[model samples]
Target chain A: MTPATPRRRGRPSRTESADTPAARDRILAAAREEFSERGYDKTSVRGIAKAAGVDSALVHHYFGTKEQVFEAAITLSFAPAMEAPRTVEEGPLDGVGERLTRFIFGVWENPATRKPLLAIVRSAVNNEAAAAVFRRIIVTQVLRRIADRLDVPDAELRAELAAAQLVGIAMLRYVIKVEPLASADPEQIIKRVAPVVQAHLTGPGL
Target chain B: MTPATPRRRGRPSRTESADTPAARDRILAAAREEFSERGYDKTSVRGIAKAAGVDSALVHHYFGTKEQVFEAAITLSFAPAMEAPRTVEEGPLDGVGERLTRFIFGVWENPATRKPLLAIVRSAVNNEAAAAVFRRIIVTQVLRRIADRLDVPDAELRAELAAAQLVGIAMLRYVIKVEPLASADPEQIIKRVAPVVQAHLTGPGL
Candidate 1:
């Protein structure tokens, strides 16, 4: 080993040559796999670091803690779809419902991307800590972003109600697997649900 | 003890004088508490019997297995609101959404009744057996009845969608406790949610 090579105090040998941006992405991906397979409570930091072929200190160096790792995984899972909220920023408010519905449905209906989200929702249903983290992500990363694009009164409440409608459908579709909704035409669901979402976003109250 | 009284085999001394309809109700209530406090995998018949202060055999006599006890408790928890399907039986179809939403919100928003229902939802999320039972009840006791009342072409699909929406809202408001929706006024929620639900029940597709 070169004496000039940087070494940390009480740290294990590096699993790879050096840290790079790709290393952080690799760690996040490994975290996703571990969390989705075993859920929040069962996954460990060392396990994720090992799977990522990085030192345990490297895992801690990148994400700091297991909870933070999960948070970053959520960002990785959702960052693509989170851009949909920004779609609301540029488009007519009327199309927001269809755009939003199609966005979420498109993301969740795909098995590859759906695994981590499913793990998070199922974990949140039973574990308080997971639920807290899940809630923070949904509220801050997703709903609040969409609400910020709106000019409506009570935008925050409307944003959440809109979220509830879609979240509920996803729960029945994926978690509870309620038939019809579980297997019904996604376009049909979007058609039926979009108007309500639009109304929540910009309609006069009853 | 009187010789006149007949005792069942392998039974503990009568926990109470004799079985009555009220005794059955007590057993059902105790079963609800056990299943709700602990998820399905953790709850047992003996624990329920002990909680109800009855012999374990008496519990078996009333409800055959752990699954049966769970179904009965779900039935008991849902029976009051299950009648909303009947509201559709007599009311105009357009108002079915409002009636249905009002009924569920009434049941769930009230803490006294929400406990058992919450247990069922949380339990169903993780336990396949509990999920099966919950699905059966949602299909036969709830959605099917509402669907039967409709003359729409895809009544069953529509019924399930409506269920998806309400179930999602209930999940957010109570289970996940998402902000805004969680604290939103029940009546206001019904007002806002009703129209969307109505559209899902009766809309022309996109």
Candidate 2:
């Protein structure tokens, strides 16, 4: 073998990149569709790879395992919850309810966020792994930060209560597609529901 | 030859009796347990019969099909919505909010009601048939009655809005088990949440 000769990798033909973000996104999109349509128990890694137009080996390379893929999907869907604390931190504490409401509505209303959110909701209801991921995200990243910032006793409780209310509304309006709620104007919902959420977040009483 | 023998089929065997309400209840209870644990798709007549300690033939005799069994199970669970109109009708319109709240909280808080309710919720989230049944009950029995009683221009909208808020709260507390909201005392919940529910039910402004 010539020392100066460049060694070529096997099967280096069309579109061979070192695991680009675009490939990861494509895999995620395909995974969401697979999970949503076929459910967690039914969807397979090879199926996700075929849908994503990537090699089955590449999927394992990127995500490690189907469980890890699912975790990635869940974490991707709940990215907003991670950002919510920072957003809350920047806003006035006095109107935390309003700010929280608007932020939640804004994220949920956006198509980019809503699709993954729908996936998360559906997965959480159907899959224990998805639910555990959701619980961890909500407890650690979302509620913990909000609770820490709260100045009242039982702040954690209040934060969770507030989360329940907000998430419950999202569940009805978005996932369940409950008619009038699904059709209700975002502004109208925010106006009516924000105060209740606000009260739970920072209001008086146990 | 059978006619000559006069084969007895009057009330049928105790295990096969379909006319008795106890048989109906047992079948329904089994359906609830099977549907809750396995979901609607995985639950079957044989599974329900196995759980109920009866033959599949007896299950079919009592309820025509799996769909019928599911219907019966749902009706049994959702009977409270039927009674809601009657209960709300007995009280003044102004107090409807408080009465409705108390009734809802009572139903959800009761083990008798909660189990079937949970079954319905799980089925609705997972199965199309169950969702249809849930939608029908809400629109006809629950929302229609409430909307008819309201003088608001968007009475239907208001009724649905009220449902969304209450159902949302229930979803979080019962299904998702979201921390404090899940564990909060029913009295404390009612005291704080009833007013918001009341506002949605009969508050000023559409």
Candidate 3:
């Protein structure tokens, strides 16, 4: 919830905002709240600024648009998988699928980041703008990068497929909280899913 | 869309529901609109009744509960794919992935069903009751059947993993409209994704 012990003050004061990172964090926090409440279409820089107790200009100064703010807010907490492409690039490739599955499920299981991530997913389902920001992150940051690392045809497609499977499970397990997926043992999921991920990553052609 | 020429009456006559089918259609249509617009948690039986111009008691008579109404509303549109588990059981197993992808995506790409299906996915993302209904249909109606037909170890888990991938694709491609995926050609998707599905269905144990 709170980003950290406020470096500058308990609240995001104007002076605190001038410190760049603190201001950005406050703006991001504001963006998350606004986006969660109003979604991407309704949330605006001005509103986020008002919530963060910063000038509208400062919200823009920290993040370019509502889209950018959303991207930053959601993906900031996705730091765990930011480098997931490397899991493919450097690994023996056989276990990349497991790593990918484990990495994503691990993120969802985590308490610190899962709340914001859930908000992002929940909003994205209903709003096109939110979907766009979410899509950009999944493709550009995660899928495309991993696909590019592979030496296969339809690499990108495979990667997207793998990502889609994980996202669906996440939808049921976390966002929707569907059972037995909602309550299934994590190892049960990992054992079943990882091999499929491996197939998408390094398996033969269609 | 309108489901064929209504044999009964243009409007739901109070007595028409006595015939069963007409009343059920009216209730389903009302349920779809209410759930799409207000989501599962927000939608009430009274609201659906008002939308259908029927007594809330009639809605109860037809669908049992709000949860049941939500279930019927979503899965009703999924009628085409209801036979999909049989596709696995009856067909050459290797093409099951392609068949499954084609079937699910086919449901999505259809004009009549897509709109309602979209509503279900969008609403389910945030609401637990809707999610539960969705999970029930997916697990019991579809996933379990396909798994039961399979002659493999952890058949249910394997079936679910394949499904998770496909469901994830639906989340991004349909619900979130994530790009390249959102825009990519369906044939292109089926080609890349089907193999992984095949692997999950009958490939060697992990």
Judging by lDDT against the true structure, name the best candidate. Answer: 1
Proportion of true contacts reproduced by candidate 3: 0.64
Which CAPRI tier for candidate 3?
acceptable
- What's the C-alpha lDDT at position B61 in model 2? 89
In terms of DockQ, which candidate is strongest?
3
DockQ in order? 0.35, 0.24, 0.41
The TM-scores, one per candidate, come to: 0.82, 0.75, 0.82
Considering DockQ, where higher is better, how would the candidates rank from best to worst? 3, 1, 2
Q: Could you tell me how far off, in angstroms, the CA of residue B3 lies in candidate 1 after the best superposition?
A: 44
Candidate 2 per-residue lDDT, tens place, A1-206, comes to 00221212343323754377878888887777777666666678987877777778888988988878887877776887578777667878888887888898999999988877776676676666667667777778888889888877788777776776677677667756667778889998888777777887778774
lDDT of 1 at A61: 89
Model 3 lDDT at residue B202: 82
lDDT of 1 by residue, B156-181 (tens): 88887777778878878887787888
C-alpha lDDT of residue A114 in model 2: 80
Tell me which residue pairs clash in candidate 1: A168-B168
Q: Please give the range of 10 consecutive residues that has the lowest summed lDDT in model 3 chain A.
A: A1-10
Arrange candidates by lDDT, descending.
Answer: 1, 3, 2
lDDT of 1 by residue, A108-160 (tens): 88887677677777677776777777788888887888888886568888988
Which pairs of residues have clashing backbones in candidate 3? A165-B165, A168-B168
